[model samples]
Every structure is written in C-alpha cells, then in structure tokens.
Target: MDWSTTIATQVAQIPRSGIRAFFDLVTGRSDIISLGVGEPDFVTPWNIREAAIYSLERGHTTYTSNYGLESLRRKIVTYVENFFGVSYNPLNEVLVTVGVSEAIDLALRALLNPGDEVLYHEPCYVSYAPSVSMAYGVAVPIATKKSDLFALDPAALEAAITPRTKVLMLNFPTNPTGAVAPVETLEAIARLCIKHDLVVLSDEIYSELRYDDVRHTSIASLPGMRERTLLLHGFSKAFAMTGFRLGYACGPEPLVSAMMKVHQYSMLCAPITSQEAAIEALENGTPAMLEMRESYRMRRNYLVKRLNDMGLDCHLPGGAFYVFPDVSRFSLSSKEFAERLLMEAKVAAVPGDAFGASGEGFLRCCYATAFELIREACDAMERFVDKLQKEAR
Candidate 1:
C-alpha cells in the first residue's frame, strides 16, 4: 500500500514537530536532566483540581455548548479584560476549544482563503507555520534578531505584507527566544496591521509566566485592533493545566461564529470537567499561579546566569521560561549541539532550528523544570560547552 498517495499533499509535506522529534531520543533515558519541553513544573492547584472533581461528583460530565459553558465563557471575558485590558462580548465572541493549538487552527481556517499569507515572526513556536499550511495558507516568516532582544521590527512586518496577506500571528514572551515586544513596537505593528487591513491572531498562552514585572499587552487592546484580533489563551501554561487541554478564542462575532461552526462539527466542545475547572482557575487560581510564576522566575535567573557564565552568550529573556543561548562558537549545527549534549552530558535541550531557520545557531533551554534538575542540567552543559571550546582551540 502506497500511503503517500493516499494522504493529502499538505499532510504529507509537513514535518513532525521538531521539539517532539528531539524528545524521541530521550524517551528511554532516565539519566537526562531536561530543559527541553516548555511546560509548568507545578501540578495544577488543588482548588482548581477539586473543582473538576466536584463537577464530576455532580454528574456534570456531559458535553458543553459548542461555544463552551456559558459560565466559563463569561469568566474568560472578565479575566481577559482584567488582565489584558481587552474587552469582548462573551456571549458572541468567545469560543472555547481543546487548546490554544485548536484556537490557532480555527482562527486560520475561519479567516484564510487558499493562498492567503499569514505573517509571523521566525524562531517562533514550531506549530505556527505548520498550522497556516494545514489551513491552506502561505506562512510568511519575518526574521527577528538576537541583537534587538528578538523584538519584532515593524519595518520587517510592513515589508512582509502583500495584497494576499490576510493575517498577522503574534506570540510574545515568545517560544524559543522569549522575546516580548515593547509597547511602542506593538503600537507600530498595530498601525501597520491597520494600514494593511489584516486580521491578527494574538497567542498569549504564556502571559502569566513573565518575569521581572514585565507586563503583557494584548494587540487586541490597541485602538482599531479589538475588532480585528483573535485573542487565544488557555489554562495550560499559567494554571499548570496542560493535561486538561482547555483553551478559548475571543474575537469579532463573525469570526468567532465561523470558528465555532467548524469547532461544533469537529471538536464539539472542550471537556465539561475542564470547563468547570477553568472557571475555578479564572476566579481563584491567581494566588497559586503567582506562586508558580515566582518559582519559574528564580529558575530563569539561575539558568540564564549559568548559561552566560559558561560562555554561551545568552541574553536575559523578558518573559517566558526559555533561553536561546548562542552555540555557534562550538562550530556545530543546532542539531549537532543538542544531540551531543543529550548523549555525552545526559542533559537535554532543544536545537534552536526546531523552532525555525532563524534559530539555526542557538539552543533553547526551558527553565520550567524543577530547580534542582535545572541546576544539574546547567552544570552538565557547562562541562559540555567547556569541552567544545577546548576542542575548538
């Protein structure tokens, strides 16, 4: 049986996620100290977990509305407005999905026609380009530079826009690089989006994980952008609810309705237990979330300092839990560095290129693991890096 001919061309061409592919090497290893996967080290707060349990006790295990539980949707709106300063009509504008991944797919399918271009920064989350391609849209990547703290340049964004461009996707406190756009830069990009009449997909999954008091500003909150942006967020990162797999999208009624149409037939709705838990998370999960955020901040500081002290040349990331350290001096490709580190040092970190081509000479180390494990990973990396530098000399 020739499976290649049977599968859709788009599905056949897309590569498996670079992050997952790298982890496959570590699957049987118990000795590895991993700073690879981006997920909270903390368990979900007990109170939030209890909510799910309580809901199940009450026999609330049935399906929710395709738009999700009305109570949860309202809570989502309130949380967004309070935290991100973005307003939405929960009744019509919010559609809950399985995860932010689903929201990304739904928004792209809702807004894109075949051949439409979606602009996003490079060295971004591995899924962005794949999602666009899966939705039959062209993924246009604008390279962001390490010299500029990896902030997205408005000029580059403007240059990437063409008549076929339909959407601008953004993830700040971004994956791999942990780049957060300054308010001024966001304003500039918002202006360009307005000028080009493009819709924006703002993924704020890591909004609560920022460090050093950095505030996350949603592009949807800017003037003229509220109507043109789809805000994607979920409980996975901040609330440590990755296994729950709940996310929601809030946007204009027409767009949300369109996404809901596809979602209704496909995903149906996020799990009822997860929706019940999410409501509790939005209402009273802040204290526990903040406690977890503080732990991540301490780990970030220690890991970043260790990387730089080992001569890896990492900049302090303003948000997110990952650091992209320069490994070019080792004279190895990102994959080679990552592989050698995993095999020789028993420390697992992702090759930067797993994110995008712009990440070629760097390595992404996530600090979302236990502090002791992080310390161990850093120690191993320092030894590994020292050997590479000595070998180069």
Candidate 2:
C-alpha cells in the first residue's frame, strides 16, 4: 500500500536536506577530505564534559523542571546579558530547547497562524524555509547579494512585508555565507520590524565565532526589539557541544510562555545531562571558545587567500567557519562543481544551491576542520581549478 497519501501532506512534501546527498556520496570513503558539514571539529571542552560526567555520578538523571533547570536558566540569563547586553527574566523569559533547530520550530509553531508569512534571507541555513513550511506558514525569501556581503537590506525587507507577514527569521554570522550583519544594518532591519509590527526570531548560534575584531550585534538588544524578538542561541558551534543537543530561547514573558507551551509538550525539556553541561559552558567556557575562534580566524584567512589566489572570488568572512565563494568562472552549476571536485580531487564541499536558489553559482566550504586538512583541501581545490582551466584551453 502507498504510504504517501496516509502521511501528513506537509511531512511528505518536505524536501530532503541538500547537504545529506553530499554526505551520502562520500560516506565510508577514506580518501575524501570533507569541508561540507557545518559542525565544529573540536570535542566538547574537558571541563564541560567533566561537569556532565559529575552530574551523572551524582545521580542527577531525572528530568528537571519542564522549563529546564532553574540554575541553568539563570546562567543563560546572565550569559546573554553580560555578552549581548540583553536582559531576560530567568523565570518567565527563557525556555531551554533541544537545540537552536528546535527553538526555530517552536517559535514558528507558537507565532504562526495558518497562511501567516515568515520572511527570511535566502542562501540561508537549509532549515529556515522548510521549518516555516512545516509550521504551515508561507515562506518568503529575501535575496541578499555577495556585493553587499550578504547583509540584509532594509529596503528589500520592507518590500517583502505584507499584512500577512508575521515573523522575520534572521541568522547571522550566518551559515554558508559567513556574513555578519552590522549594527547599522541590524538597526535598520529592527526599525522595519517595528514599523511592520513583526516578530523577530534571531538565530545567533554562530555569534561567538566572529573574527577581525567584529562583535556580534543582537537585534533583540536594540530599543523596542526586546519585546518583539525571540532570540535563539546554542552551545553547538562555540562550545563544540553539538552532540549535547542544547540551546535556549529568550524573549518577552508572553512569547517565551507561548514557546514553552509547545516545548513542554514536544521536547519536555533539553536533556538533564546536557543542561548540566551547558551550565558549565556558560560559566567557564569563554577561554576555550576564544581559542576556537582564533583557530577559525586563522583558517578563514588561509582559505580565503587560497581561494582568491585561485580566482574563485571569495570574500573575507566576518564570522562563522564557512565561506561561500563564487565559482561561476568554472562554467559549472554549483552541484556539478561540487560533484566533480568530490569525484576528481576527493575534496568535498557543499553545493551552494543546497542553501537556496540564490546560491546557484557558489559553493560553501566549511573551515571547521583541522588546519592541516584545510590546507590539503585548498591544494586539492587549486589542482581541480587548474585542471578545469586547462580543459577550457
């Protein structure tokens, strides 16, 4: 019997993740050096890992409050305030989530009515558009160009707004493109959100990975935005706690309460052990994070120089470990370029189109791996480009 009709239409309609296909292609291949996945190569810092182990040793395995451990929540409050200058009430304004992924879905679920429109930048995280669709909302894409360093344009945002637009989903130090929105740009977008009376779901998982003396600016910290923004952050990128599956959302009491209703039923709470680890991450993980950020900065500098030297037209990423380089000179679609590079050079990078249609002529190379491996991948890529140029002749 065909199961397609029996499943929820939206679930059935959801497209498979574009990144998965590259993983499938290279799976179990020892020769391939992958720059595909966005995950950090570092293990969770020893202190944070030790804290979780100690928590288990103390027999603290039971679930904490549905809102997550009060202690953890309080630490989150302090972390955001001290780091971003944003204040949140731990008791009612913070809800722990399985990850920023879940926080995105929860915010959408809580705020969107059927047919409500959610506007987000394109060439964005692969999950953004699908998450909106999963919530039964209309997904609107705002195209950001490389000319602008992929920053969200206020005029483009204003043009996308309609009476039905309910939310503005933002990711910075953005994935794939690695662009950080400047304070002035974010301020303009915040004003547009305020003018349109839209909710802002700011995904800041990569906030700590910025480089070049640039600090991350959270839109939620702007005047009048605190009440309208649901800020999402996680331990995955900065703390190398991807396996821990922990994140949190902070916002006004009512919005946090609404997201909590969905979270309490769906996730119950983030894992107790992970919550314990996260407390340690917030309290004692800054030095480790700074070290990791510095490593990424070096890798970024090396990779961008190599790509530009090869005539790939890569911009210096302001934040995050990934670089989106324009590969149109190779006269190949993004997918074809990625496939050929994987097959020929055994260096794996994500096809930029995996991110969105606007990503068609580019490719995303993640520099979160070891410095040596990144250098090797660059060498391999240079050889690949040279071969293509020779072939053109």
Candidate 3:
C-alpha cells in the first residue's frame, strides 16, 4: 500500500543529476550568464526546419514503421558509411529512437541480462550509468584523469572487465569533458573487446564536433568492432536538433531486431515529421555543420584560454562544447563552487561532480554560450577568482 516501495528501488538508488538541480535554480535568473547546459546555443538549420515543415504540410503526421521509415534508415546508412566508415544494413540493422538517449536505453535494455556489468569512461554523460542501472546492470565507471586528457585508459578498461562484464559504453567528444578518441586508441579498444566478447555501445552524438586537426574516430568502424558495436548517434548535438527527438542505431541485425521488439512496446517510432527532417539533416547538414563546428572550436579556444588565464585550470576542449576546469584551489565542493559562481560571480556552470565522483573539485562550463556572453562571463570570472583569492589571503 506504500507508494514509495511501488516505485522501483533501483530508481531511488540513482541520484538525480547534480547538473540539473542547479540548472533549475538558475532558470529565469537573468542576472546570471549560464554556462551550465551542454545543449548547443545554435538554432536548427533553416533547411532542416523547412524539411519538417514540408513533411507536415504533406501530411506525414502519423508514426512510421516500428523500425522506422526505410528511406530515412538508408540515409543514415549512407551517412555513417561515408563519414565514419561503419557499414550497416539499412533493412535490418538500424532502429530509430527518440534521441541518442533513447538509443542508449534500447541498447542496454535489449542486451543486458540482470547484474550484467557495464563499463563507461568518466567524466561521462550523466545518463549512461543510471540507464544501465535501470536495466539491472552494474555500472562500473572507470575514471580518466585530467593528466590523460580524459582519454579512455585501455589498460584500466581491460583490468576492470570481469566474466560478468557484458557491455562497454563509449561517449566520444564527451559531454562535460569534450574528449575525442583518436583512431589508434579505438583500434586498441577494439582488440580488447574482440578478445573479451564484450558488446560495445558507442554514444557518438558529438562525432561531428571535432576541433583543430583532430579527426573523430568511431570504435564501430574498426575491423572487428563493427559486428559487436551498437552505434548510437542523432541529429541533436551535431545538427542542433535536440528538440526534434530523433536518433538512430546501427549494429548487427539480430540486435537491431531485438531492439525493435522493445522499441515497438516502448516508443513505436519517432514522429514522421521529425524523421523526415532528420533524413534531410543527415543528407544535407554537413556543409553548415562544418561552419557550426568551426564556430564551436573558436568558442572552445576562447573559453579555455579565459578560464586558465583567470587561474582556473581548464583543459583544452578537443571537441564538443564543454570545458571541465579544476576549481579545487577555491577549496569549495563542486556544487558549492557552482552555486558561488552563479551567485557572487553572476555566472553559471555545472559542477563536475554532477557527472561522476571522478569529477569532484571541478566544474563543467559549456562553451555553447554565445561569443559575446562567453567574453562577458570570462570577465566576470576574473573578478570572482580575484575576490576568492583575496579572501583566502
């Protein structure tokens, strides 16, 4: 008769995101310049928006097939093949999900047996560990140090694996930490997984956001890894289409088929309008994407420089739109530091501990904010750090 027990104990065990709690606090507080959210500040490209508009005008309002429209899946196949070198069978190897988040859930739910061990690198996207837990999987987080440039440690990763280990979850150009796995690193992981019979779930939503001369490598593209890797990517981060609720997965056919059984029960399919828009996005968004990525690189460079110059030890953001900086010198807990940054500093950033325990004593500042806002926020942080130092003295 108790409402609390009726709620799953697993759900209670999972902590609400530390990032979101403060995000709610800062909402509608115009006095603060927010760098708390990882979402891009860019609008979805006009052509992609128009594609959705056209789809709706043409009466594509109902849901598509449970596996999704074949046409869109084919486009995704071509996109992945051309860009990431991951070949997928459009007919049976791709499943459309609401977003990369949902695609991640599908992979875990479909593949994970109870108590299966799932490994992911940290500081990672906030959702990965909890998502595994929901599927009755054990989340084994392997922390990557700032010294390693937040790269996944193959030795540590291999050492963490046990007989119970079933899934290796990967997020590249990662949320909050912006670490990209180079090709050579991914091949080593591929060899490790091949030796271990581990299933790979790669969250590659930020694949298009690489900066400088760095190329984003997909673990799935490596020779042996493709068969075992369930690739999760979407239009959200790359095309600034987070609100569209569109994503896709490509993997071995049997797994994709297994996912649709769950998918059919879970979401059926994404909106037809959104699918049509995403098709166009996958097909045509590249040119604009390069421009947008260049803009993000510029922002990343500026934000990293500003933070370090202000005495916060920010690492270079290789990709994505986040900069995780050490705030340990302030002697404030990450959440308290974030709160102080928002209050006295009149600026906002997410506490690094929000992502994982490995993230303490740091904060994840999203460089997705506008250049103008970034410049002003940097100026504000300078004064804020100056005051904090003076107080300590």
Tens digits of per-residue lDDT for model 3 on 1-393? 987789898898888887778788888888989988888899999999999999988888887899889999999999999988878889999998999888888888999999999999989889989999999999999999999889998999999999999999999988879888877788889999999999999988898888888898888878888889998899988899989989999999989999999999989898898899998898889888888888988888988888888899988978888999999998789988888888888998888898999999889988888999999999999998998999999
By summed lDDT, the worst window of 10 consecutive residues in model 2 runs over 1-10
What tens digits encode model 2's per-residue C-alpha lDDT throughout 235-283? 9999999999999999999888898899888888889999999999999
- Model 1, position 318, has a per-residue lDDT of 89
The regions of model 3 sitting more than 4 angstroms off are: none
What is the per-residue lDDT of model 1 for residues 174-223, given as tens digits with 9 covering 90 to 100?
A: 99898998889999999999999999999989888888878889898999
lDDT to native, each model: 0.92, 0.93, 0.90
Q: Which is superior by lDDT, 1 or 3? A: 1
Worst 10 residues of 3 by lDDT: 13-22
Q: Please list the residue runs of candidate 2 whose C-alpha ends up more than 4 Å from where it truly belongs after superposition.
A: none
How many residue pairs collide in each prediction?
A: 0, 0, 0
lDDT of 2 at 303: 96
